[model samples]
Target chain A: MGIIDGKTICQVALVVKDLDKTVEEYAKLFGVPKPEAFRVPEESVAHTQFKGAPSKTRARLAVFDLGQVVLEITEPDEEPSSWKDFLEKNGDGIHHIAFMTDDRDAAVKYFEKNDMPVRHYGEYEGGNYTVFDSKEKLGTFVQVKYEPKK
Target chain B: MGIIDGKTICQVALVVKDLDKTVEEYAKLFGVPKPEAFRVPEESVAHTQFKGAPSKTRARLAVFDLGQVVLEITEPDEEPSSWKDFLEKNGDGIHHIAFMTDDRDAAVKYFEKNDMPVRHYGEYEGGNYTVFDSKEKLGTFVQVKYEPKK
Candidate 1:
């Protein structure tokens, strides 16, 4: 089976310059109310790591559940996270398309074996995520999130 | 109701530097056989227009139907099309997220009224599509396709 055998795309995230303005525009486009924007928690809580080193990367985020997939809008700080890197290199555009994997470790290893190693990784309340440097092949980074069974 | 009152996103398109290589990688990533690549027909057949002028823009395209949303990879030629412009300005990345709209003309009018005018438009075999310059606020162009009932 392919590393990501499931076909469900969980999320599509974009890095923008202005969080509020982008959120408003999306809200209007989708004909929905603007979801509240929240900042990524501090490094102490988020434990974000970039390229194997702990980094204090944070971003203002707003999410819209567009039924089929979640749409994320982010304005990242001047840190070393993947979102920040994308914003600086490509300006405001899609950063990643995320998929949920049952075995994060195995999936990451498969990508590494294919020469697309992990670029950034972090933890949330229920799950941990890895960002692969798959842009060379995929034209965009692929983020795999794993929420292990409790 | 929002301009796009639909929650189902039909497609997400990306611009790539090499269509063959990218399609191969994506096929492996999704554990599927490589879909054949096809060149967009000439302007006479496609009737492509960019910024209100007839333009001969062509691209090699490969598509993967990932259930919930279709993934389209395009490599544009040295022509004046939306795909070409995005490739020149942003390298290779996500170009547009498209939705099916029942009333495409009205949706285009709404976007234009909001200062996001149509950047490119063209006809396919069964439908016509319009791309909006919504990147300033939405971080990526939004394309709406209209296929009228016969």
Candidate 2:
């Protein structure tokens, strides 16, 4: 038994240059009825960090619930964000693959043991998450997320 | 209704430099039991075409069934392959998004009407597929595929 798996993967986030444009583009391409776009308020993610430093990077976001997994399209602000870095270097493409971990500590330990280091750590709502700098070895970063307890 | 819906999308193909390495890395990261690698024979795709010409682009392929949609890892051969073009130009990342189409002809026409031209097309196992060159506007190629008739 392991921590992350196909079932544990919650979403695949993409870094795009234009949030609203891609949202419309996807809606038309996928023939979806109405795929709405929202914003991941930087204020809400007050505990944000970029490149291991305290920074307030914000993004306009949209989520498409593709049954088993969600597809997140993120358009980062002009701020120097990891998402912006990806969009500038790789253009609009996959940025990170995320897993919902019930136990964040165990997941972090496991990832470190596998030679994947957590580059940036942040908090959204009451939950904590870490971004693994796995792009070089895995071609994309890996994120492990936890939900705030009610 | 749109030609292809979000639900129609079956897989997101990634062009990697090393298939074996990526497969192993994913298996370990996702904590999967074991994900085996398979090679797509060049001759089998006799009808393959890249940039509007006959081609023999093969790849070491592996499918990670991520429940709702599958993640296809492809390492194109050194030959002049679209996959190779993507890898050479963009490095390892998402190459295209594929939707299983019911009618290949109509699907191709629909995409063409939307300004997304089919750049590569091929047939295998009695099924047909087309790759639309929508990377500029949409950030990635879109593929339409059909299954063999019963």
Candidate 3:
């Protein structure tokens, strides 16, 4: 199977300058409840990298639903992340499109073989997930939204 | 009844430099078929406005499904269009997030009241649609993807 099997565009991630206000605006835009904002617990993500370096970057996250695909809004907090990069360069806009799959390792390898290299590797729910450097190849980055086996 | 009524983000539209190449690249990325390319025939749309004036612009379109939301890739002709504006400014990335609705007029009015003014308006398939000027308010533009009565 290809890198896309069992995977779907499950999220559209945006880098916002003001997390709370953006969340409120999106809630009004979607007629949905204001997303509860929180910082990603550092312990939950492991082996994280930014620009190919080991990263201890922190960011605030706000999540909401748009059908099955979630909208992930991020605001970098003192961390040099792609979120900060997007905000500094583009002000605010979509940063990445994420695909959810159980077979993230295989998907990562397949994409790597296809010339998209993994920029970041992380553990969520004790499982593996990766961010592929697809900006040059696809005009935007891609995330392997995986939850590790419990 | 808010600006969003039975409306969900059902599409993410991108303005690309090359229609055929982008479609082929996306098909390979998703393991989906190459979407048939098309142009939004001028006669198919009525009362269209671009940059606050009546428009006779033409653009190519290629669409495919990405889970519940559709991915629409656009290549504007020589006409001055938002697509061309995006290409000149950002090269290629998401241009707008479209929320599907049946009540086009009310939705447009609601957003206008909420400070998101209409940037563009037109009819496709005899249905009304609008792009809201939300780049300042929401970081990215928003579209009222409505199917209006003929």
Q: lDDT of all the models against the reference?
A: 0.87, 0.77, 0.76
Candidate 1 vs 2: which has more DockQ? 1
Candidate 3 residues B4-122, lDDT tens each?
74237788788778888878777886777787898766844566676687767678999987767888888888776677777788877888888878777778778788888888777
Runs off by more than 4 Å, candidate 2: A126-128, B44-46
Task: Output the TM-score of candidate 3.
Answer: 0.91
What value does DockQ give for candidate 2? Answer: 0.58
What range of 10 consecutive residues in model 2 chain A has the weakest lDDT sum?
Answer: A37-46
Rank the models by lDDT, top first.
1, 2, 3
Backbone clash count for every predicted candidate, in the order shown:
1, 0, 1
| Cα displacement (Å) at residue A1, model 1 | 2.2
lDDT of 3 by residue, A24-112 (tens): 88787667788789875583366567767766766888898777678888888776666777788888888888887777767877778
How would you encode candidate 2's per-residue C-alpha lDDT over B1-150 as one tens digit per residue? 667766666777888888888888888767775577876555656577888878777667888987666888889887677898988998888888777877787888877887888788777666777899887667678888898679
**Whole-structure CA lDDT of model 2:** 0.77
Taking the tens digit of each residue's C-alpha lDDT, what string does model 1 give over B51-145? 88988877889998876788999999888899988888888899999888999878988999999999999988899889999898789999998
Query: Candidates' interface RMSDs, in order?
Result: 1.4, 1.9, 2.5
Task: List per-candidate RMSD values in Å.
Answer: 1.3, 2.2, 2.3
Candidate 2 backbone collisions, by pair: none
At residue A99, candidate 3 shows an lDDT of 81
Superposition TM-score, candidate 1 onto the true structure: 0.96
Query: RMSD (Cα, Å) of candidate 2?
Result: 2.2
